[model samples]
Target: MTQTPPEDAPTDAQSTFSGTREVDPRYALDEASLGVWLTANVEGYAGPLTVRQFKGGQSNPTYELSTPGRTYVLRRKPPGTLLPSAHAVDREFTVISALHAQGYPVAKPWALCTDDGVIGSMFYVMDKVEGRVLWDLKLPGMAPAERRAVYNAQVDTLAALHRFDPAAIGLGDYGKPGNYFERQVGRWTKQYRASEIDPIPAMDRLIDFLPATLPPEGPTRIVHGDFRLDNMILAPDQAQVRAVLDWELSTLGDPLADFSYLLIAWAIPGSLRNGLAGADLKALGIPSVEEVVARYSEKTGAPAPSNLDWLFAYNLFRLAAICQGIAGRVRDGTAASPQAKSMAAQVPALAEGAWSFAKKAGA
Candidate 1:
């Protein structure tokens, strides 16, 4: 049984997650100090800089830095305690710097500040990509044809990403190559346990079941752990992707894991996490799951997974674990967003959904 969004879930995702807001007081930084650093570190930077925080990004606190010359975006590790190996802005900078050189749709890398004294945490800045960041999966105002084009662009971009040879691009050692699923299961399970607030039997059951059912390892590629509609910037007047944002969870791993995670939008409901479970694809002009898979196959020449149930289960559990980490942050006074509590509240339902998929896969 797929989980539906809660009644209190924000119905208008575009309104909720789109655009920028005044910096949250908790995540505020010293604008004068940052401007000074940018002048010294980032080439071609001049100030009279004004900063406003972006409303999106749950893991890293991002800001829009406006200057007389150009605009830049900053991503930083959240202040105070953090989960191990989480919020690697340096890694984000490295990957984007590498990919941008290859003409990938990612922001141009500017500079990375490792000295915590400048901002109380490590941070990096990049070109502020100019485009639309659509939050609503239904794409409310888009024409049906435009919606179809956007969906096609989305699949095309992902396939292009998967086709990149990490070694050829100087990312050969980005992450461990083989035993991707087994390692991921262990990693998330450990993180979940570290962040556990209350006992979730479903998560525990998954921890036990997933390792035993590990699928055959596939060729490793760069995996964007949270690739989804919201993570992309689209051209203002076109269906093309201008840039892909938020590289905090990217690493060398199974490309299928990345694709399967994107497929979750078709499985989960909009109310829960802005998913498309009950969406009318024909009317909306959005591609069906089969159409999406077929298009990906056409682009990548890889066969669709014969069984995605296990993959869905693993992805849901991974998401639940991530949200649980947020819950732990809320408890420890390190949560970055005002919506962290609401996100934390979904952990139980996500765990249950994962368990349902596990059962479907004969857990």
Candidate 2:
């Protein structure tokens, strides 16, 4: 969602996260050492590399590597202590490498560097995708029809991913199958507690409520845990997705949980992660939640999900925990993006929203 910023306006998400910035001093790496490693490890490698960091608040620090012939993107574990099982750049590379081989829309992974000496942490490099990474949900300058098409493409892409057989793709053991909600509740609860900066009462309520009222588990499939518009790169002149980025949370899980996470945009307001709650969907050409779900069901040959309220509640609670983790990072002085503080501020509101949905689910 990179767009040129108006000279007089304050920075918005589109401007703030649209392009690359000078590497943050905290996440800086030795360019000479990285270049040498790339030359040795990457196929058809070239030197005279230039590096810059992407502006998004990716838990894994991502850098753009440019050379005379081509550009590559590198994702690495952030320096300093990280939460257990977090920032798995190797997993990201593994998943993307598998998906790319299947002709899925993901950047082609080139090489993974496990040696911490090269970059202060493990990192992986992939082809730099050239496309638009949209941030604003309303899609300010896009025509109404184009907006509808883009949303359809997103739904279709996700359904395709969900339809893939993990075992066939060499990822059957990527994560435990079945009991997806139960395991996720436990996992995120532990993560939330580990990263708790302040006691959020709503979060506490959810931590207790979600586990007790877990939804029925569906068939296991590849779940892009953070699937959303902002995470995808759209073709420069078309509405189609070119590549889906950010795989830190992806695993074999309930497809419905992954799909419901995208539906969160319709429940939350536009100010939060560019949601569509209060927007005029007809005027904007955005699909309603029902339409989105129906399309997904049609594509995957699965029934539309039931117990959505509980699912939304769980997703929102999980999101709050994630934000709280960022708050912990801020407290630890290892936050990657300048926007981490503001994202941390959203935890309370997210928790509150989760509780509201819990109430709807008869919690």
Candidate 3:
């Protein structure tokens, strides 16, 4: 099998350059190498093209590709080491294509190359959506007139995802819904065990508490596994959301899980980062958790759950667990960021926050 080049792969203590830092026999295609794959699959105008990689996101590496007369974004599974079925290339394309047809703002995919001969794995091309995807949007800097509108727009966008019906769209089998919270608890617990090179007592205890503390009932809808301002494109001309980006983790399950994730980050923007620099949480202008829950209630007709504390704690635990996974790969030589060295330190506060939310979760 051929391999894709690791443009962002982290080298061992190399002066400067970083990677997710895991080693897998599976390879990623670099620009020069990917050009060969493009030649065989994507046909339009050929010749040298310009490609610039977009940074951000916990998974997948995306790039803005430009030829003399064309513009596109390439989406491929992250190369190097990874877990099985976790990066379903076809599932990603299918959901996005379905969402596009449903009038949900999403970049339209033009082609998919599944031939292993092409680039060692399946990859696809889609038209790149225009606008800014600011992770740390500055709320204080915006004109006051548009601030509330933008915040409402963000709320409206999440509300729209909850509005989506997978059955109506012919995606009934998108994701399994059996034991949703239990499975999450089990999975993270396993990840913690696999990465427990150091001690994390509270994480262990929180894992034990999750299954029992889950929301009283599960509400199913299309979940955007990871939803945030950075993954969304705000139309430059309007306060409305132009498109929802990054559906790789999307599935058919508890839509509330998604809402919970957003609320976790939304309620305390900088609070979650634990003194991480370059995170100006206020610029994004995330609505208050109450605003978000209330708007979602108004639009979706499902009132926010009476016991929100449990959900909040669960969300914090999941985020911290995810970072723990990142820290594990860093230690295992899969992640190459020096920042990974400090990431494991985040667990204690993260666990504490989880417990804190637990206290208020039923509210």
**Winner by lDDT:** 1
TM-score of each: 0.97, 0.96, 0.81
Candidate 1 lands at a TM-score of 0.97
Tell me the RMSD of model 3 versus the true structure: 6.4
> How many clashes show up per model?
2, 2, 21
Give the Å shift of residue 34 in candidate 3: 3.2
Select the stronger candidate by TM-score from 1 and 2. Answer: 1
Model-by-model lDDT, in order? 0.88, 0.87, 0.64
lDDT (Cα, tens digit) per residue for candidate 3, span 1-363: 011112233332122221122222323455666677677666674648676655443445555677877788876665556644455667778888888898887888777777756555667888877775544333435765566677678778888878877888877788776567777677767766666667777677787678766655566688887776556788877787888877876788777777777665544534222111234334544455676788888988887777667877887787677667666666666542335445556667677878787767542
Ranking by lDDT: 1, 2, 3
lDDT of 1 by residue, 1-363 (tens): 011233355767677777789998888998878988999999999989989988777779999999999999999998998889989999999999999999999999999999999988999999999999887788988899999999899999999999999999999999997999999999999899999999989999999999999988898999988888889999999999999888888999999999998898899875554678887889999999999999998999999986699999999999998988888988998877778787889899899999999999999
lDDT of 2 by residue, 11-71 (tens): 3668867789999999999998998899899999897888999987547888999999999
Please identify which of the two predictions, 1 or 3, would achieve the higher TM-score against the true structure.
1
Q: Would you give me the overall lDDT of model 3?
A: 0.64
